[model samples]
Target: MAILPRSQRLALAAQASARPVSVPAPITGWNARDALDEMPATDAVLLDNWYPDYSGCAVRNGFVLYSTGVDSSPVRTLAEYNAGATRRFLAAAGGKFYDISIAGAAGAPLASGFASDAWQTVPFLSRLYFCNGIDTVQVFNGSSFASASFTGASSLAFIGCIQYQNRLFFWLPNATGFYYAPLNSISGALAFFDLAAFAPHGGNLTAAVTFSHDGGNGVVDFVAFILSSGDCLIYSGNDPSNVNAWSLVGIYRISPPVSPRAVCQYGAEAFITTYDDHIPLQQQLVALKLGQLPPRSKVSTAVQNAVRANLTGFGWQALYYPRGRRLIFNIPNADGTFSQHVQNTALQTQPWCRFTNMNAYCWGLFRDNLYFGAAGGVVYQADSGNLDNIGPVAADARQAWNTFTDPMRKRITAVRPMIQAVSGETVSFGLGFDYGDINIALSPTTAGAGSPWDISPWDTSPWSPDAIVDPRWRVGGGTGQSIGVRMTASANAPTVWLRTDFRFEQGAAL
Candidate 1:
């Protein structure tokens, strides 16, 4: 009886198709199945003309702006705005404050009281509240504008604003605190009646927002404060009037070097990009859910080094699209453009993807539509159509499998890749042997046209299911002690890799 060589078992565990700073060992099952340069998904088309130096973005009262002028622009502008009574899309631009809701008419300058380029707007009680920490908060009740008597700290500027629980909250950065005004207050006072004291951090207030989570018993609302020193304080309970009613549910820390404005709530968690203490010198994209404590796991490790190398600075912006369950982070890239790190939470297993071309500076979701303002004054509707910025869609994924080691030399007989290609799409495969020293391409497969219901041919075959495909490709002859595989797809067509199988036979050891 002859002794036989031992067979080995190995597989690539499911992981985000991330581009790591350095590739892991061939045995580490977490290597990305896609390349770093290839976008995680298809590219989106540009929806409007360029609006140079696009700055802030917001969606309210059923209007979306393709671009808003930066602070320095002569008319800190918006393409359109709606006053309550008008059905016309008003073009508002010019002066410190402008109203643009009149049809076919140039926007008129708003009240001159507002400070130049320092406004943050929020919608509540059928009115749009515009606040600049340097001036009194302004309100537009659809048809007209008025100023509210803000009875906060004297000269306390309102840097940010949000609406929660039928109340309007404003971030008083100058005071290093926040104050709220009840929407139904009888006195019509916009006063800092309730102060959100952050005594623990000693006041480095940067940004604040509200989020809600399912806290076992029921849904609970929490206010999150982001400080310049990287500490995040989350408080529970709706009313800030009663100090005891608010409880500190969690105190988490993010990278100290982060833009104060770079936080957004998605589902029950908030996502931010900042330096990771564990991996010094690298910025990590992290997620913090309610009740999840510090030492948060880094979700962007696969691309941490890439992110650190490409970031122009700490300026970042983030937003969540609930309809798509996607969390998008926009960071200025080294080349002046922006890199959008998109995370699809619904796909838990493979959640991260990168997008470019839009170079979005900010994002807003209005009326269930996603809009982003990019450089050169361009605005885009994400995932709107096939083309990207009116150009060809460039999409690809590079997958590397774990090394298949054998006690003796092995001759690879067959390689079978299970892939699902969208109809009218084609996907290509590539193979690498001996730690990818040698690479070869396999036969490309073009998916067949799926069954059509419009055709009148009664004698028709059953619809071709996506799962049924002949992925087996013969690799005539090759002997290797260890083998690996790399697969790629480059086209507008979408493809998904289900799995891959290999067959080999024992041979003489090298």
Candidate 2:
């Protein structure tokens, strides 16, 4: 039997009473809403702790202890400061902000004494600004951190802030209005851009973002305001102070945004994390009068139904990691656990996978690396290695069950998972027949030290006799017409899942 490796197509190797079915790693990614047999072969029924790469490739997501050992707590907000030639990363916990740019027992808090720790920060004009609508706004200019007190800044207590059209834009938390400072001025006089008169549904302002669009004329910047009732007010203009220049484009409604940071910049466009959908700003802007959704982006279609139930949960965020070509959507569970629905934006199909062991409360990018703030008052850098600082990275994937060749009861004789080798690493695997649950235990093997150059294998061996995975054919026990491959694996190095080979014997057709 010969197994051919194609893009995502299955290569069959038929032998006497044997069916060698090559199951490729699902680029169609995680599907929790669809039926077992109704999904494509490239879709996963259960995928966790696995980070999908460009192709149908995945590596066990790993993170080391970037910063920890302060008071045990949850790092709810991760903030970044961008200086012209350098960058600074900060974390918020226990009503204080710490300099997490360096990895260690987080040094003395950069700024403290806040009633609330959940802050929204943005870098503008070579400084980092912080706001939460509870306390006075603060600013950090690489060295000094203090309350921003300008001529008219004492009354500027907004929940969020962003730099749009060479100006500082802010939105009031419980008011259906927004305030904008003068062009390129972070201080001095502030102008109120009231949306309460424009909001048809009439709810408090939730967030504000600057959206860039082309309407057959040229590129223009539209100031977008999101309301608690899902009313979105889009306006086109650079200056809001000039009444004639600022015009209300339209007021459309969408799902209520999770937070002020629900919208993330994605290259020329942006993505909004709504309660029920991951809507693209450009595509949404191009829609009809009501800003209806267009053809599915398939970005979060598979798992959105499950995510809808947890819309009210805290710690929801959307981040676009340009360095990793990823769009990570952090989901908060009712049980306090967190999982990320990651989309590989590099791929045209935009395959998505669920990542376990990444209990991220907030996300930030600095120095072109991905970092997440989680519990324990710690911030960890992702994609660092194969092992997590919190614990071992346990990956589990259940392929879509399907009846191959003929619809007949068959016995799964044996199965072999073709995994890319990383010297000597342990791999625990098990099988699930029909829709049964699968449990795979850990049995680690000692790592192998590569042989020295020009060293003879017969004369010298790296270490002791190790019963490594070898990924040899293991005995599989399953008796059903539809079969699925269940694997749980982890390593300290990059791991690629090519495909799984199945050997089966057909029995009664009925």
Candidate 3:
């Protein structure tokens, strides 16, 4: 076989490591990674359009904005033809116009005057559910329409809302009253959270009510709300327990067009986005310091062993990890202060995945990846690993070293030495070196192969060349003081150091 040179070999190895590992897209596993490659840019959907339906409108930005019309006409039965009506707005967003049904199937055209907003897919149910007007709730079973009618909602007027806990929750404008219609049981279960007393004249609550993890803190749990005034309110989720009195830790009031809807945490920073603001101008997504938690340490070594983990804050409302992705966080604008340079690259990807160019939006997270609702009811997902913890590894020449062969002379690639441990004892150890390995001799005298020593089963004498040996094994208990030997290398290989700990179990008595 023709062998590649060391230089060429190393370069090939590095390049191979750089390419992202691809996984199949949800459902089809169709490797849609390149689906949007040749997609016509003219067909792409913009951020300004409204999508009303369950899994209603998907956007490339990793969010699906479903609208639940506040009110609906009871008498109109949408025939098959009208059920899938295609409408072209005065402003064209270039994508092919397709009927928005429950799932490209049978459903009455949306009840007249019914508007949809931020309706998310329900787990285990194929239907997309949302609140329409004040008194009515609607559902699309991927094929047909089902509705939950309300008696008092016909006249209840509200502005700006979100879906939570399998119910449509919204705040009435000017009245500041919170109402919810359960999609599962809408008739009698239709209830409204009496927020009228809390914010009379209706303190504009922009989005949905959400909770946070207290991590066992008993005093108070936090709930979040966005005011129509564009201010954020963080209050206690206390129900008169008095353990924690509802108080505002931070008040955020951004300018108009800067309507804040979602707030999430990333490490110690909180990122928030507005309803319709795009990239920079809308200040759509902003990062803020988490008042409850401390900043995460950069040093990986220190981070693993530190006593204080520094995790804090309440949970999120609108955005959540449905599938694939592990950790998702949002940052508020820095100190409620705006910066012109910072852009919310929240869901930017090269070779964007285009599904009919309608709209791409993220619904949930599973297995550390994001579950997205792309155009055509086709779903797409991306692993969160690629987005988080991205940076070049800092290189250092002086940190390199070797061991075993010649600490001061020979440069070693890798090395391992023998180790002998006694049973019933706990062993604590550490490795300190520059780069190369240091060999350590476990037992000085040992019976050669084929004798009782060989039959002992516990003996690893014959397999001495393997990882069984520690290059630098320092004896313990006597003059050695229970400390293992030191393995020093002339060069370091960005290695495994920084005070490691592990339990070593001995097989048999020496």
For each candidate in turn, the TM-score is 0.63, 0.85, 0.33
Best by TM-score: 2
By lDDT, the candidates rank as 2, 1, 3
What's the lDDT for residue 138 in model 1?
Answer: 69
RMSD over all Cα atoms, model 2: 7.1
Q: lDDT (CA) for every model shown? A: 0.47, 0.72, 0.28
Can you tell me which runs of candidate 2 are displaced by over 4 Å? 1-15, 69-72, 150-154, 215-217, 285-312, 405-408, 438-471, 506-509
Error of 2 at 35 (Å): 3.0
Per-residue C-alpha lDDT of model 2 across residues 76-152, encoded as one tens digit per residue: 88878878776788888888878878888888887787877778887788888888888778898887688875454
Per-residue CA lDDT of candidate 3, range 194-303, in tens? 44344423365555444433337543334455555554444543322233733544444432222222344442233343332211211221233322322221111221
- lDDT: which is higher, 2 or 3? 2
Ranking by TM-score: 2, 1, 3
Report each candidate's C-alpha RMSD, comma-separated, in the order given: 10.8, 7.1, 20.4
| Candidate 1 residue-wise lDDT at 43 | 14
Residue range with the least summed lDDT across 10 consecutive positions in model 1: 51-60
TM-score-best of 1 and 2: 2
Overall local distance difference test of candidate 3:
0.28
Q: Where does candidate 1 stray beyond 4 Å?
A: 1-121, 130-140, 143-149, 173-175, 182-203, 213-217, 238-241, 244-257, 277-298, 302-315, 348-350, 404-426, 433-488, 493-510
RMSD of 1: 10.8
